[model samples]
Target: MNSNSLNNKALHVNLREADMQFFRYNCGGWKAAATLSECYQPDRCGPRRFSFVGGGGKTSAIFKMAEELSDLAVLSRPGAEKRKVLIAPTTKMYLPRDGCVLLSPRLCEVREALAVEPYVVIGQRAALPASAFEPKIEGLPSSFLEEAAMHADVVLAEADGARHMPAKAPAEHEPVLFPGTTDVAAVMGLDCLYRPVREVCHRPELVCRLLGVSPEHLLTPEEAARLLMSEKGQRKDVGTGQEFYVLLNKADGPEQLCLAGEVAKNLESMGCRHIAASSLSPAEG
Candidate 1:
């Protein structure tokens, strides 16, 4: 993992693909081999469109998902052909990390690449305002994303930013999703549980609003469930026909995993059908 991968929110993760099986960190990177379950055979079929929102590990989730779907190109069974996946962040994102190829904006070049590569990541170059040149890429416009979606078998897009918080409440303009998105996975970190909103949330005010609390609010597991399920949170702007999923991330230890299970139960009671728990951060000593 890069020095900044874990420090930066929803931007990068350390993942490597090998041996027909993907190797990721114990947290979800290049050391363990766990089910990249993707909440239900995310690899079922293609022309599949997936988008990620929420904070915590959204970026890591996308890369992990890419590791899962790109393998479709390697299947040697009958009718298995080179599969293509396009990772286009509809909101601002860092440039492509390891384990992915960049998608050239040129149509011919893209076509050529698709003829060989299994997956590619696409984003518009973004110029940061404060710093003197940083490597960054903002999301493509909806129209352009739609145009590019035509060539890929699977399209994975990041539709939100959380500045690395494990949880967040979306402002009115947040989470700019692709129009064709078929599934949306919302992630929150268990590490945020019991932490103060001002300390762990990307938009504390919005989260406070949703939780009916103050800046110093310590998020309980129940509050975490409420925030994850609230329309005013990461679920904002999610349209009909799009399946919504909740991922409780960074559940690192026995206690956190136990707490994540509790949150998952509450989410189920609140009518969320798709829920998963994971420790998606690199293991720390």
Candidate 2:
């Protein structure tokens, strides 16, 4: 099975259940979870790789997903072999504090961690530059990621860096996805709505270029949809048959939620297949 074949691929929640399941992460098989999310749509556990791009709460989504899959698998197959969930990155990121963190690049160590724990965070810790704040975990090599993916039940990779911003526009070499990534979620914050794009977005210059607007342009629902759909935005490096989702984040209040719904409507009109909106805790993206 390929890496893009798991249950919690990425966010695509059903809007009707927004007040309830939206924040609970109660989702499964993308289509059924359509009432919750359009992430991975597998009825049973399968080898699935999820690469999260854009920003918003991607980091939070990944670990929550790891835990969800672990519990779901354990309950679904009592007394069966435990599931393997790997949280790795294709770019620099912080290692998740919850899992059995294996910062080593060696597969033997990864195998060992997997034996002891169902969820593992694999990466190489790198010191930041002098001006930067702290050390961050660098991604594993592509070859290593591919090899590790083969041994894991679910693989979640953070492919783009957003500096914790709500939205972003990838540069020429941004969003580094690993091989066989089945689903990619372009996470953005609904809070960016009505805010100056330059203030709320990462790589605002690129966003300006994509939207043909000035840096001070405020983001609107329709413009947000355009950015989410633009090849220069979330669709960068995405291949056919691989699912792409626009996950609107930070819809914490009714006002924001309403704006998110508007964005969803705009995206639907543009023919975007997978879309979700929710308020997430502060998680890495």
Candidate 3:
């Protein structure tokens, strides 16, 4: 496969399509081929509301999706009109790495930002190092996110908090997903394999309680996969008929890649039909 072609394809995808053509481009016939045992198409349905949960690359997924959607939004429009992609979180989060950020939740200010930039971040104000301008913008409220949905071409929301951990098990009230979320991508980092649960998993106790394992137990690929596929794992709070997508991220080396395959198998066994394993580095604007 031509690496350049894959990158270009991925860079142009509109998240609303629900067709992972870029995924096919990157994974070749292995993961993307319809004949493959693990293959399943994500539902190409409405709203384009994606709520990213789980650990690992939630932030990376949000930014990457935002970047891709922004490109498509701009390309879909003609002439000087700019289309917008909004990155908000149901929970707290740092500011976006690039683009204009609006602190106010009011719709007028958000519209003004969209007028100037295709990519915009909206949230309340938070105290942070002045140099970290984006982090200072606390995430917007859920109601505002629903309101913003009508205006932006796509809404990518980071619905869970992991406190920067590579893995996690959600608490009872965690993941705060929006009611309109059409797709929920549960992310897991492959690097956490073989590490002690306490060392790798956020909310280690929750992981232990749900998995019925000790916090110090070494995390196996199977165990990690089970955590994400468990009823209380990715399935929690997902509305009826909502789609679930598993993203096994940080498959950066041979060992991690192998583990990612196993995780995919486990997810499929547990009824997660749509899965993608990738090493997503930060995308530059």
Candidate 4:
């Protein structure tokens, strides 16, 4: 049976209940795990310079991660000092709503602001007009990101652009990951399943080339799984010794959750060490 049909076989269930199931199945093997955070190693040091690529909810995931890291008294490893987070994009990104947005012509001034603000979004001024939801911000140069890593405790960089699509195949020059990035998160939307590639994926032409399928083809679990594991696709420019993770975002319903399970299983088989199937929306405190 095809993967699309397999995911459809299961009945929908509550999202909270689905969370635990994927945590168990996707989190390698953790004997005692009640909460989502418990599944991974408490001592596991999070990446100092992290980059988020892929197609699904990259912006939301970036902000949500910054909030989660900021809330933690300790940043990952024990005795680690809790410091502010820096959210800058290697590619263009909308200004964050909750955090302070600072655009300084001089990188020195930007670094100074980061020292006082727990959350600061720093980037070049974009050509677009700033709005309530979509504010203007251009991307920073790779040189700036390499140097900026020294100023913040944790840095989150949106390395790819998807034009708000849930999935994407990277272009020849996409996902400009900086050399200092110690970890990478590849996000894909679970909602992309059974949808036409052209509708849900960015760079549909490239996705078609990589998948060897037509743009009109329905995105299946196996196809999505292949793209996730493919070096030219999600794993592009993944530096040596960098911690890599696949985030199956938007698993809000049982069906999408089930699809995430299938995708995670494939990622695991392809040697993905960490996989998370969850909503990227930041939870209310």
Candidate 5:
């Protein structure tokens, strides 16, 4: 009925096949999915596995979710020990053993975060560079997907665009050949910041009132440049629902908080879902 209950149900459903297969192969006994679900219920002592993709706010969200679930369970029963929920981050970084693992290229950042406290550590193969050969398949790795399905109670993957830059003006100018006047002039530029549609547009807390067009749907860089140089506007309807967000990433010291607050209010007014915000400062006590 509630979000937590829904999540719990999803967890139970996901674990069914894995638990049954594990028992059938190792214990040499037939175990039903329902039995395994009961064994792994919220109040049980069994370890719960939650696998998640790295990057974005997913890690933070999962951490918050774990804390909430634990608190809810404890509140429901005054004298009960909270169930341990393992939070794992899958990247090309160091791997975690018991608590969580970082599995990709950004190893340093993950290591620093983990070193602040004791946690399970494990490492995986480094991520392949973007310049590597194209995949034979269109989607994600089958092995990765199966592992997520079988081993994880909850898997949160960070979805992002291939290449994105914050909204800002260009720092340099390029020389262009002109037909007449024997003179060269610098061109005015428009700075636009790009972000994943789901992260930006769909987020109620960000206060994004308008939908965004994807890079794939937009005109080519050269075409856009030509239009701008000729003082002609190029408007192409990429249709709605491409899933990306854009914003001016720059704001003054006081303006940042003001903007954030405004966005929050707008989101609330628009009936947006799952909105959250946090501020991190090293100088804070």
Candidate 6:
């Protein structure tokens, strides 16, 4: 994509509220729209709601999109009124709900510094006391997952990994404790189970297998775009009908990046025209 293309019209979705504001200024001029719930219906447009299950790079990815697409309506949790950007100090301390709350202190510090909310922070979970747990938390309740999905325009769920021992070394691992994955599993019930895979090694076939759907059924970028238009009841752009885009956010590790590339290629082959891939980070350039 060309630098000039960055100014194109798009919809932005993000986990960090502060980043939304940053993008408003950097990406030419754009609109904002928050997904009030987790599951966003690609078929419907106008206004929609979606939920956010905090964790992973998904939140960062969403916020980046929201910033890029500044002209659209931005949707977010009504309760996220304080509008703080949180950065967890350690991996172990990140609890979806509480993490956002605890970072209020760091948020305050950073907001004061930047004259803008801090996009990241470093701290331990206050509830742990000494910073360790015997078995660690197992999983999230199905009810909570469902509730989050209900409010999002498109639920960005992490469907890999489960709560377990952390892996060691050059190989990167996906922590199995994602609430979004658990929610999807529960929603699809016995019908869906995301097979665990090494973070970088995950393949489209594996995802298809977990969903009990065919690899061929995976929609291409163009196909995804067409579906979005049809579902949202949008007319041809007149000039260009593209109203939104999907960001396939991946970890910075090489293996995960490779896997993301394959997925992007597959989506392109299938015609998902509006999808793009990027790494998750909190700096503006």
Best by lDDT: 2
1-285: candidate 5 lDDT, tens digit per residue: 111111111221111222121111112222322221121233433333332211122223333344444443433676754433323333322211123433321334333433332222222433553333321101134344334323322222222211222111111121111111111111111122123333322221121222224433332233222222221111111113211111111222344434433443443343322122222111100
lDDT at residue 23 of model 2 (Cα atoms) = 31
Question: lDDT, candidate 3, residue 67?
Answer: 60
Better of 3 and 5 by TM-score: 3
Better of 3 and 4 by TM-score: 4
Candidate 1 scores a C-alpha RMSD against the true structure in Å of 6.8
Which ten residues in a row are the worst by lDDT in model 5? 174-183
lDDT of each: 0.68, 0.71, 0.64, 0.68, 0.26, 0.28
Clashing pairs in 3: 95-134, 95-135
Q: Residue by residue across 1-285, what tens digits does model 2's lDDT show?
A: 123122232332222223433531222211223222324453344688889898667876676566656654524555766667888888887644344666654787777666657577777766562234444687878898999888887788889888878888998888899678988888888878888988989999999988999888889999998888888888898889687777777767777767877788778787787777665566533
Backbone clashes (count) for model 1: 6
Tens digits of per-residue lDDT, candidate 3, 1-285, equal 111111121332222333222222132222443321122232243446778888856766676556645553424445634446777777767644445666664677666555556566666655563354334345566677777777775677778777667789888888788648777778777777888889988899988888899978988877877888777886678876777887777766667666777777676676766777666663211
Please identify which of the two predictions, 1 or 5, would achieve the higher lDDT against the true structure: 1
When 2 and 3 are scored with lDDT, the better candidate is 2
- Stretches of model 1 off by over 4 angstroms after superposition: 1-12, 16-34, 73-79, 97-104, 129-134, 282-285
TM-score of each: 0.82, 0.83, 0.77, 0.80, 0.32, 0.30
CA deviation > 4 Å runs, candidate 3: 1-29, 32-45, 73-83, 127-136, 282-285
Once fitted onto the true fold, the runs of candidate 4 whose alpha carbons sit more than 4 angstroms away are: 1-47, 73-80, 105-108, 128-133, 282-285
Q: Which runs in model 2 stand beyond 4 Å of their true positions?
A: 1-39, 42-45, 73-81, 127-133
Report the Cα lDDT for candidate 1: 0.68
* Model 4 C-alpha RMSD to native: 10.3
- Give Cα distance to truth, residue 157, candidate 6, Å: 3.7
**Cα RMSD (angstroms) for every candidate in the order listed:** 6.8, 6.9, 8.4, 10.3, 21.0, 15.2
Reference-based lDDT, residue 193, model 3:
84
